[model samples]
Target: MVTSVAPRVESLSSSGIQSIPKEYVRTQEELTSITNIFEEEKKAEGPQVPTIDLKDIDSEDKLVREKSREELKEAAVEWGVMHLVNHGIDDDLLERVKKAGEAFFNLPLEEKEKYANDQESGKIAGYGSKLANNASGQLEWEDYFFHLIFPEDKRDMSIWPKSPSDYIKATSEYAKLLRGLATKILSILSLGLGLDEGRLEKEVGGMEELLLQMKINYYPKCPQPELALGVEAHTDVSALTFILHNMVPGLQLFYQGKWVTAKCVPNSIIMHVGDTIEILSNGKYKSILHRGLVNKEKVRISWAVFCEPPKEKIILKPLPEVVSEAEPAIFPPRTFAQHIQHKLFRKTQDALVSK
Candidate 1:
């Protein structure tokens, strides 16, 4: 329920401010934790997020395909996030998608405001900046443009940028490709769980009913980079999130009591297993907590596509295949909308307690 009308970080960075606003500053403890991340990473021996090559995913050799699937499954269980190389999306298409997002973010503030979101009114799509609904009310040092791109009929083209003539066209093509990739990942994950290849996908939502939402995150350079985060730590609610980021590094994931910065590979897409998948898999798969950090140099941009279930569809419990007398359902039945409401309510209560 936090509605943001704050100034974009891009504008703030260029405003000649020596430091970020107090509201954007983190507490001393939070600062200390992140400041020593490098030292912690050095001492820690944890499973690093794996980079899996998907070029041979459809290989004629059955052993090669099986090995690829097992690697993906292990990454899902251990880290819940992984980078995919040669994911079949064309290099030209990838560049076009990045350029489209960059073009939109490069527009003047007023022009960008034409598509601003009204989160207060429950409209989440379009351009906006979110102020975290936490105890300190810290403002995330990022601006984003969000909208659903799949199931073409669900699109609201009015909010889509018009200034960049090819934005819609390029993004639409990218979405279709990502959707296929998502389906393939789900199939492999399902097989890994000893279920039919399509079991997990069907449990969440079939291809036609699934929701694919796109969010373009632009983390601008910050004056006080140590004190402010580009994004707050949290887990994604979607089933899967496929990301394409400009090679500048900032993404960090919590793993085995350490924060590990994900090393970016050019022309690669990173994928995350989200809460929905974790719930459906009966906690067998993880939904790791992650956040974005900002730096004094260079803007970091990422394009994330979330594969989700329709709001009204009920995730009635963990998949039958994953549950047994030994391992019962760990999560309660809830519609996607109810799950969102519960999370929002929890945030509100946490804020109140901290205050």
Candidate 2:
């Protein structure tokens, strides 16, 4: 019902402006060339890595232990994506979130539209999908309930979905779970780098600068799966993300020059490295590019929680040890704020990829 027959480019405001050339916009066909570099799926259109149920895996056993933490780092540095089986978040909580997401999105547009983004009217933002043109491919069948996670209390919580009050409770619980996992993994990263937890905290900031958005993506059964993708190929901007997905599969990652399917295990979280680690690790680790593909037979759901640096933290220079006089900085230091703004509004794949 929210479908727009044709997408139009929405102009930006005069403030906080930068002009990107118009020709940079790539169509669905053009996206294939970049994707082909890493994907093995031979469909004329996209990858079809199968999704697996997490209940089948024993996440209680870690592939690498605390003593061999370097192995953990090596794995992340090499793979950038991992499957977490024993994460232990309650199943009731997941179901609650799903129900709340469905309840809110199913509301009449008149009610939902009250919170819609109003660039023309200057109201800024609220719940719902990005403008159709924000994505190069035909849009995903997902609907989301988004809110700011930084500066914690500074957000206008009143504008959030009032009907799904329990959504706040469920999502906040998930945020805490994700934060705990991020810290646990950070400790491993510290060990791998031969640094201590305290040092790792200081290198970034003692602050946890992350955006905890509960994206409730719904994939209605599609008749034509190849004509469009659930999400286009792209990289996540956070240092890492903890994802909880519905049993229905479609998540795929570009890896080792082949597209590998990320099998979804119920109750397990998917850990993915983002762009920041590639810089912090001195390119020892590269963030993986991923996309969502829909199915003709099922509906899908995913909640991706992004763990990042604080907006005020300037990741401009590498930790002195990581970059020596002989080595150059991987990329100029930029604030989490700038990274966030670009993620929210930049209109093209080239905008993120070229830089």
Candidate 3:
């Protein structure tokens, strides 16, 4: 005989609002019961993601720069991810950004609601606590806020936090620094592919249309961590993503058909190739599949900046330099919007059937 399990419900009390239902707080017992089902057996240790120094890439020595470029190519082709050090962002600035995020999240729930995401309107540039309404069993164990930074005109202040007055300033400064780093990295990647340094940048539409978006993710400590996933497995949908992970070990990526944890390194940033790059390279490079694991003890926080083509509708195709008669295009041309919409649809479908 089959048995039916009752769904769990949670409540949230905002400042003015009396009660909010279906917030999805799991109990320890419930969490433990599902742990065994999703747990994976530990695999033997293997190579970790490659680490590269930005200083070396900027060296005046031609041989030194070429060597760094080769290393980048190897990392991009083999792991689709790498750890970046000495990227030139101020350490104090990084700390300030993290502190700003923490302060906003710590605000009274009512205050945070002012920036709540409007799913019906298809705007994701605000705060979001729950993944889906009334979908108790299908929720992800995290809270996030997203916003666009570049092209200043595209910024939607309605969703930006006003309580922490410096939040905007801090994030903006950090993004500026990241933008510089991203441009350099893109040029290095082009060289690695045997193309003119400016070729890839030109194809994606120079700095004028370059898009940079920020996502602040907070993963609260879970009572039964093993049973819940902080984030489900998926590949990013942008050209590249730079992650400022707090001192936590919850990030993991699939490499060589095995899951490997991404350990945090001090004073460094983690870079992951996204779907756009894979298409642009004609599959010469890969978009890494990764996920977040929850911890029963520590709450993890991370800041991710996704760099991609502008919001304008432009079809992304494999560049001619990377595709030829000898090596045809592996991925067909598609607009960035189309690619993201499809990914979201698939994620929604998966959530609906998750339990």
Candidate 4:
């Protein structure tokens, strides 16, 4: 099991090197002193992505299903993101998950560290502050915990939170619901690509190896919100990501050559394509760049569930049906593991350069 480290405050000037704790409530002075290298000059007007009601797709009428498919396809190609409504997940379950996240994050730094990320072993399924290496001493102004929920054998219970009493139960139920939804979404996307609904799922090893990972992000209020970023600009590495964020507006997506703010709709979940999906669709779909902004007064919490193929080695490439003489494959065939590793390395390099 990975050991947790307590947050320690050292008396250092703004210009001097300082070590920020993995999870701690930041003081007003400390929040103001942190440099924001990701400040933006202007924000976009509104959400560029469209919203789709899943109920439309579930309708008994064939015409309704077709229309919903068309709308989803368009959103996938144009924005690579969308909001999902009537997704069938219980509101109470969502509330439970949120409460559990809050409980865990509210724990003392030392307690939280008990499940620190095992970086030495390249395991990220635990509490951590940054995903990429901070060789240049620059980091995002957020704390997060990552864990795998599917493929039960692959889960490390040691890293799972024991406190919050119902944290495990709540997360487990949430994961079950998310898995079913993801499978349905993937089936719809396959139909949108002019293939059998189950084709894409089968190619990725179906339910057996289906990888479902969850990330809970906590962004504390920053005194100088304009000068700091909760998370840097980047695209997800999974096939698809479903996110539930509170009303605090901070999520932004890069669209039409500008950064547009993603507005939160009550009880709605945001869904977005990831790099793997882009590759599977042969450039027909997109994986957009997004980031989290900080606020001066409100703390933000978000739960993101990432869906991908099973762990067994599988080559990821655009389906043949989606590619032809008119549209050739744009990406080379690569194993899923290889693709993820390459993306992580590139992100680390980019982060280092930015610092």
Best by TM-score: 1
Q: Tell me the number of clashing residue pairs for each predicted model.
A: 0, 6, 0, 2
Report the lDDT tens digits of candidate 3 across residue range 34-79.
3321233233357677887777887899899888788888898888
Stretches of model 4 off by over 4 angstroms after superposition = 1-47, 131-137, 348-355
Question: Regarding lDDT, does 1 or 4 come out ahead?
Answer: 1
Give candidate 3's error at residue 179 in angstroms. 0.8
Tens-place lDDT per residue, model 1, 1-355, is 5544777878898898998999888766568656432343344365567999998888899999888878889999999999999899999999999999999999999999999998777788999988565555778889999999997888888888997888999999998889899899999989888999898888778878889999999998887888988887789999999998888788889888877888767888999999889998989999999988888878889998999998896564688889999999999889888887888888778667766
Which pairs clash inside model 1?
none
Candidate 1 runs further than 4 Å off: 1-4, 36-47
Model 4 lDDT tens row, 1-355: 6554322211111224333333332333334433332333133454456888888877789998889878888899999989888898998998899899889988887798788786557777788766335344445778888999876777777788999999989988988898888888889888888889998777766888778899998887665555556776689877899999876777778897767777677888899998888989997888999878776557788998888775447888888888899999998988888887787677668656665
Displacement of the residue 105 alpha carbon in candidate 1, Å: 0.6
lDDT of 1 at 286: 97
Alpha-carbon lDDT of model 1: 0.86
**Candidate 3 clashing pairs?**
none
Name the top lDDT candidate.
Answer: 1
List candidate 3 stretches off by more than 4 Å: 1-44, 133-137, 345-355
Clashes of 3: 0
Candidate 3 overall lDDT versus native: 0.75
Give the per-residue lDDT of model 2 (tens digit) for 1-355.
3434222111211122243223233355535533321132334444333222333222455652443455456657777777765556677877776677677766765687677655444344465554455434334434455555433554567776778778677766666666665666766676666667655545554445444544556555544454445666788877777777667777778776766666555666777777776667666666788887765556666767666666675663455667767776676676767765666576557444543
Instruction: For model 3, give the 10-residue run with minimal summed lDDT.
Output: 5-14
